[model samples]
Target: MSTTGHHAAHKVVVIGGGYAGTLAANRLRTRPDIGVTLVNPRPEFVDRIRLHQFAAGTGQATADYGTLLGDGVRLVVDSAERIDTAARTVRLASGRALGYDYVVYAVGSTCAIPASVPGAAEFAVPIAELEPARRLRARLRELPPDAPITVVGGGLTGVETAAELAGQGRGVTLVCGHTLAPSLSAPGRRSLATWLSRHGVVVLEAAAVNEVRPDAVVFADGVVRASALTIWAAGFGVPRLAAASGLRTDALGRLLTDETLTSVDDDHVVAAGDAAAPSGRPLRMSCYAAGPLGARAADTVLSRIAGTAPAVIDLAFTGSCVSLGRRAGLRQFARKDDTATNVYFDGRMGAMYKELTCKVALWKIRREARRPGSMIWIKGGPRPGQPVADGARDDHGARDARC
Candidate 1:
């Protein structure tokens, strides 16, 4: 809609202003002829990577869109209700219809608390999203200093939350459904275990919660433990927008796309971030993947406009980092394919690395906003012609439960 002497030949509407959507919108600014509009439910950008810190009252987790998005991108503070791909229109929850030549589907994942677990939906507080983290913070404020806190799930979120609360002097217990920090190497897990033990955190590996009560959790093995507060960090689920919109999606509702990040059903609709399952093989859901995928999604759209063949997605992962608390952390390195490596960093060095990673994530988005096409990622992934193997998705679901 900018009339600054350049009329837009095409318009792009990016849904979900998370790391992916924001980057896609910013990257689209490289084409002045393409008007870009970003749709998000909230006005500010939520730094989801730090939601645990927000819940634990250790740090903040939001930034102004003014600082994160490019000037060429318009911000629409409304949720996308549906996408009519055939019509190339996005219907907003506010009842407005946004016509776009192309659309970027990046409506990230959410906390998944199964109702199958008795009372979990009612008693357990999930800290995956901003609102949930806010609720957890308020609830923590209401509890006494010696309140017994129970963190369920052995993933990164669970481990981090338990460590954070324990650092605050609360009696904490981490109930890992299986191995603790399952995504990390054995030594990394042992290091975390030692730290948790030294801080009086009772880590229950292989303990799955069968039920959550008002004051305790019942394990699958028939053990009942008192819990003043139960924090759920089990895993994440994507929005049902794609499936409801009639687009082809994977079992979990993530939009199915080709290696170029374009939806198989409609080339005009592309996907990125956690909501994207490319070639039926989704990379681990993490901010590390989100930004690069966002860049690729935008490039794909740009390529179509230019009548050029967009290159296949070439992305790699270096590792994953988890903050133990304000001053401690564990950084586990990974292969290009995203599997755990034996190399790990712990203690203050790890904490510093974790903080740097978070800062760098935001910095990358901002840098792209200032200079489109300036971003680059680790390459050397599977060749485009290769068939995706069975269970090809590199899953570190527990480590990136928030993604």
Candidate 2:
């Protein structure tokens, strides 16, 4: 008989259904002794990385969780209002209470447009979530042709949105607070710049947007430009449930975890995805790190249940893939720590590669959904006594802190 067959089913509740939460829940199914419950705000899975594509109307962002989650896991469609670590229960906004032996916090993140910026919260549309993407799509449909559409921030999200809209023939300007794709290599930026120019996107460098008016963006230097539609993709931010629940958060409300991905305050609680900060060192907010973190979180629970010590987290990133319209893209290579390397795959080849990369990411999720514990990530170097590094933190934590 299997080890799982001899034990009572352990109830594991995973909050949030983004990349990390889904992966962790599905992976937990590997142990038949575990009864996994996945709680999500939406019934369907949102491919957050492709929200720009969804905004551009190139593809849909949602998938039925029924087909994406493992059969061994129960799906609860509701918002988690509070987590009671002492009782190992999660209270849902719908007045449902869920009991669990282990709780995985993975509520993901959102765009970091500051409410302090005048008119920003009211005027700018962020493509981080489904509703905002739908609103942006609706706005795009209503706007007149040849209207100026301004995309704020020069990060990957802004670049992709600008490129996608520019390809659709909307007059587009990208307001880069400092530099364009600062994380990209020189060649990578050159290729991106070429693509943007080909798509007729005006690049604004070092223009800090101080205020967002109804019809324009005012820069810190008092320069104002007309904008028919303003898309805010500046940064990412997390939710506040961890802090509200009295969990120890690192100023930004991310659940603080030890190197083993176990919550510092509660042994029954663990976190993955954008809501996790491991040993004060978080992974990037991107799916590049979230997928692996989800799998690692499951391993911790599995190891603990099997009477072995859980392995420490060792996440290493290889590169970043950004799509510049459907025809162009950049696969900027990076060091294991996620800093840019001189090497890259660019242009048409890069686009094809990025397409493949995205397919693979979804494939990973689906594959695990069908066969839990099948998806895994590259293991880092030998675990050091003091493993956390300041520079190697996840991007999500950085975005959360800004919010």
Candidate 3:
């Protein structure tokens, strides 16, 4: 065990090695005054947004996290079982305890499947993790060319999966509980609809699923028989780590965080990615939010350690990018707050844009992992206000008053 002393440096613990957690650890590693430790089950980072492409038999989507994390950041290859906030310790499944001065909770999220839905768990496959998506891809290759496939959920994942399957010359149908891409603006939605139609994808909006049979998906109004494969790409909820830690969280298990991404119930604990809820509003679960939010969490931690007041996390979603396949996609422009605007792009240009976005996201992770503690250069434009300096804030604010 490392000796504890009255040192000038503060220890920062980051859970999960996905986009948000990895970036947070990398950013914190840049500061010599901060001791950073990253805990995750996997040594490599998987680009989850491209899981659809992997499922459609494209290529492997894994990157080495060892080379990605900056120096001075300790990589703990284990799952975090629980976080003891009061004790400032994290319990790992490997039977080790990590003590930290600050904790960044970026445990990420999971694909939620309703237990009430019969046969759903037994038969349907979800692209929640990389292995499952890869398995689905292998399953697809084994099926007959004209086999019927049903994709549940009309959200971005479902749409992308259906489009990819259709492009692969399989008969595909999308079953959605509400309108397809419900979060998208009219122009983006229309563009997606046209693209799906062009690729021979049968979209059934407002269709509530009742049960899943061996070869069919039964809906409330009708039963879609002849389904050779079923893909569930529904909504996602955060892992239960926050609630299990006795921290304040939303109904979906997202940690309730203040404007600066610090946990409301414990200032020493901050959350980002799919596991973080920003005050009254719930940030959308996307890599776009996670990447920036991760950096903000690290900044908040670093500022607190340096006694500097952390800048408020200004989370503004500029737009949405959805890939239909390798060749087609939809780029929907939105306001700073993510309100969909009239601007839309389609066809190969949109696909290229989506690919570039993924590249940029990975690039940010790579850059931060190498340099650490540096401000992520926003490609579009500058954000208002001066960057918060490290160690300018009071230490008393790190404790939760209510506790």
Candidate 1 vs candidate 3: which has greater lDDT?
1
For model 1, where is the 10-residue window of minimal lDDT? 387-396
- By summed lDDT, the worst window of 10 consecutive residues in model 3 runs over 394-403
RMSD list, candidates in order: 2.4, 3.7, 7.7
Off by over 4 Å in 1: 1-7, 383-403
lDDT of 3 by residue, 1-403 (tens): 1222225268888998888888888787656677778888887788887777788887566788766777677777899989998899999988999898999999987777778889988888887678788789899889999989999888777877888788888789998787787656787888899988888899988888888887989898776566889998876657888888899898878899877888999999988777887773555677776778899899898888878999877755566778877888888777664566789889999889888888877788878866675545333222234222111011100000000
Regions of candidate 3 where Cα sits further than 4 Å from its true position: 1-8, 375-403
lDDT value, candidate 2, whole model: 0.79
For model 1, how does the per-residue alpha-carbon lDDT over 291-392 read when each residue is reduced to its tens digit? 999999999999999999998898766767888888899888877666677999899998998898899988999999999988888898653644322221
**Each prediction's TM-score against the native?**
0.95, 0.93, 0.90
| Pairs in steric clash, model 2 | 282-394, 283-394, 284-394, 284-395, 285-395, 285-396
Q: Write the per-residue lDDT of candidate 2 for residues 1-403, one digit (tens) a residue.
A: 0112113478888999988899898898887778788888887898776778888888777888876876767777899999988887899999989888888888888667787788899999988788999999999989998989999878777887888888788899998877787767778888889889888999998778889888998999898999989998777678999888888887666789998889998888889988898886666677777888899899998888888999888876676778877887788877666667789877888788877877777788889988888987776633334433333222222321110
Candidate 1 displacement at residue 361 in angstroms: 0.6
The local distance difference test score of each candidate is 0.85, 0.79, 0.76
Error of 2 at 370 (Å): 2.1
